[model samples]
Target chain A: MARRNQHSKEELRAMAIEALADLVEREGVDNFSVRQIAGKLGYTPGMLYHLFVNLDDLILHLNAQTLDALNARIDQAAGHGDPMAVLKAMAFEYLRLAREHTALWQLVFSHRMANQAPVPDWYVDRTRHMFEQVEVQLKDWVPAADQRQRQVMARTLWGSVHGICLLHVENKLNVAGDVAPEAMLESLLDHYLSSCAREGEK
Target chain B: MARRNQHSKEELRAMAIEALADLVEREGVDNFSVRQIAGKLGYTPGMLYHLFVNLDDLILHLNAQTLDALNARIDQAAGHGDPMAVLKAMAFEYLRLAREHTALWQLVFSHRMANQAPVPDWYVDRTRHMFEQVEVQLKDWVPAADQRQRQVMARTLWGSVHGICLLHVENKLNVAGDVAPEAMLESLLDHYLSSCAREGEK
Candidate 1:
């Protein structure tokens, strides 16, 4: 019975986490308080404390959950077709995810270890594995003459995607004004594909 | 007399802006409120708002200032240096600034946009100019490559840099872990440089 009660409490805590995320997004994460989070859910601050230790604890969970979701999206994208196809799909899907879940995505990417220490290998492994997978697929796309150039190609292509996404996220681009992100990305794709052929020339 | 007062007000706002930037770096942007900003300097939120409409207005000012600073850095790096070298430096500097001014950097990159309309062309110009500069420099790096191929190479390289920076920002790895960001950046540079050479090989 105690175990059952504890499990139920954990589930409620998860729900609270979602609510907390919504609240944070609605109200800027800055100046957010435990009291406000509890108020939003009609609970007392002490009740909230029973589940998570503090704001940092809540944040850590949110960051970890976002990364897990991102990895899942990449994995799902990877499953659709050939490795090369999957690689392209993963890139698009990751960008889409970031666009759609802007708040959650930003939280994971921005509010991280301000004065904290180094990153762990497990986290490094998950991230590295995804990029390596992309590199592998890219190698298959490249001409047989330059398979050795996979890693950098992977990095460079990914950087362009990110640059565009960063622009979108920050509202830094007047996307509706002249050139749209889609058009920009389309050009990027065309350029990258042609560049692969150039690798064979020299 | 009115003009003199207007100029003094502008000067005070500018000073406050710089102070706010420094404070955001020291304290997570999420940690403070307008009241705190006022408290830091023995002023009032009313005084802060007199120069701007509200907290969000102040944020916009700070973000625009940060972007201008970033452009200067990019311009300096992009000038007279080898294109790839400049591209690499521009990227590293972007990440360096992100680390140094976590709050302001987040404002510039994250979707923290509020009460804001679509992004303007000035932002796009910065990005387009950067990309164009990169393409021009790459022409000298390779033996006459097609524009499309160069674009892809540029995109891929940019992605790699973003991925590394995003990784750092998201704290996907342990902030207290073993991998040094500088060493990781160096690895990325080496890999991309070699990859650019590979692009010419075919």
Candidate 2:
């Protein structure tokens, strides 16, 4: 009897999904094909059909994976440090991912993340958990900020950091020099923080 | 016999571009066809061909109009107010435009704007002129702020505003109901300006 492959169902599923990510970047999402994916990996289209009904199903899976990767990065970075320092670090980490994974970031982010098919409940838990960490860290920084202001401030920072990252990925900023973006972001954050310090002195 | 249309050339061009914008929303930039534009209005594709060489020419024309519209909105909102107020108003106007015209905003924004064929020098003039107006206005607010701090401050404000606008358009904010975005933005502006005033005091 021929030796049987050792991979279990779950292992095979993981492998297929990993392959899908590489395929998305190589071939833009709009043109991706289930047949093409299976063909490149020496699996028949019939096997892919068994796993995913169509490109939408594959897209939903990829979207969830991207969010999980983002949540993991933030979680890992937040592990040890002053919460304020870690919050700033998380901003850098988030921007770095957006820069490196522009195509994938654009794909999932261009469509609202929550609008996609629901991922496992843990996914929402992870996202909300990360935001809560950010919120608490921010309160430590701006103790006088009211609950509403705190929420809005957090949202503003979220937008500001993401904006710079979006510009970096899209080459939107018109600056002449090749300045390190993260360094520029650090400077911006420092100045913003200083303004707050000066405010509290009054 | 060809009958003369009542609308002036400028009016016709403007109307046609409005129709073009509608087509773009229905079909994204890549899928858009000049033939479809003419067909929708019962005109032959030849009419569109006569106005522009290809899709690039047409898109460039449409995008230039968008930049012009931006300048008009900024002029209407900010004029030569307090430097900080000018930036604040522009931020508000930018958000308004982005929220109102989601697809068109993405098109006219930095990345897509740069990729299109080089517009006339005046077109560049309009964009730069607006930035220059802000740079000049920013002077009064940052009288005490160092040059580098001022640069970073302006950049941060602009980036944050852009980022927030995009997040809103993407429906990622989950802003509370019954609160106009303007109200929230205006309140945030007050908070930011008050903080800046404290910075100026020191």
Candidate 3:
């Protein structure tokens, strides 16, 4: 009880989320429980409830953290270069993180809320930020594209990249051939971007 | 027991898979059990064991059935036409099936076999056959592409399409904007095929 008082509610919330991430990374998101996180933090489930409405709320917070980490990685990879080169770098970086943190990445996309609850606005903003990274680069690479076109192109390209990675992570890419996900991503970008460039010329 | 003896093993296997599909459709793949399936078939779990080695084997059969249904749908959609049109029609047919049969489609991709057992050769062939649909059209669309280029191109294109659909079905496409999956698929193919044609010209 004394230990609990030593930390503010915000600090306890952060601690619980960190513990949740570690637990999920080790055990995966399936059938995960708040009790396990509370155990890790040396708090009772009741105490943890003070920080989160429920397990869903806690998982959402953890997913938000994963999104933050992904954004940071993309930002780091967005070095000065040709827009095409930067986009590819960021994509490969995204793939690397997904591969390295498979559990966390899967949770971000796979953790459906109870009863199909609407994702909070902040969480949607995080996802939008990911697409915006691609949008910014597309703007540079295909300056003529209107906002609608840019939005579709960014989603199409990244969605494809994501599909490849999702299949790769899930061991479902075997049907695609022996070609690595990296090669497929490169080929996809090469052809799609070239097409965009040609369209721009026309 | 008398009822079980009346049906051949093959008949029983088919019945079990049908029941499994329905159960999964109604409930979902999560925490699915062999007992529910046996109950559906008026057989005991031990009897189900006679038909399938275990739950994993049963689910694989269900997935195989799903793939066969998908291939059939693609065949129905692959009416003779310009290769581009055929591909687009086939892709849309796929998107339609995915949306309508969301649960079955999800089970096919989401079910990971226990112990990481290798997916059987027959299963791999079914997946290959799915890609072959795209390859046939690509050959007509890009006559210059060799077997390897065709393979890469087919996978890259379909993988992107699959990624887009996966996101849409999972309700994760909200970040992409309000563009329907159908429209996005059309835009992706238009850009990618145009790019390939230009490359062939070069």
Task: Give DockQ per model, in order.
Answer: 0.18, 0.33, 0.59
Q: Candidate 3 local accuracy as lDDT?
A: 0.84
TM-scores of the first chain across all predictions? 0.74, 0.74, 0.93
Model 2 agreement with the true structure over A128-182: per-residue lDDT tens digits = 5555556677777777777676666666666667777776676545542333567
What tens digits encode model 3's per-residue C-alpha lDDT throughout B48-118? 88788888898888899899999998887777999889989889988988988898998887776765588
For TM-score, the strongest prediction is 3
A best-first ranking of the candidates according to their lDDT comes to: 3, 2, 1
Lowest lDDT sum, 10 consecutive residues, model 2 chain A, at A111-120
Candidate 1 accuracy as TM-score: 0.67
Q: Candidate 1, which segments miss by more than 4 Å at Cα?
A: A1-7, A18-42, A80-82, A99-102, A113-164, A175-202, B1-7, B99-104, B116-163, B169-202
Preferred candidate (TM-score higher): 1 or 2: 2
**In model 3, what are the clashing residue pairs, if there are any?**
none
- State in Å the error of residue A88, model 2: 1.3
lDDT score at residue A106, model 1, on the 0-100 scale: 64
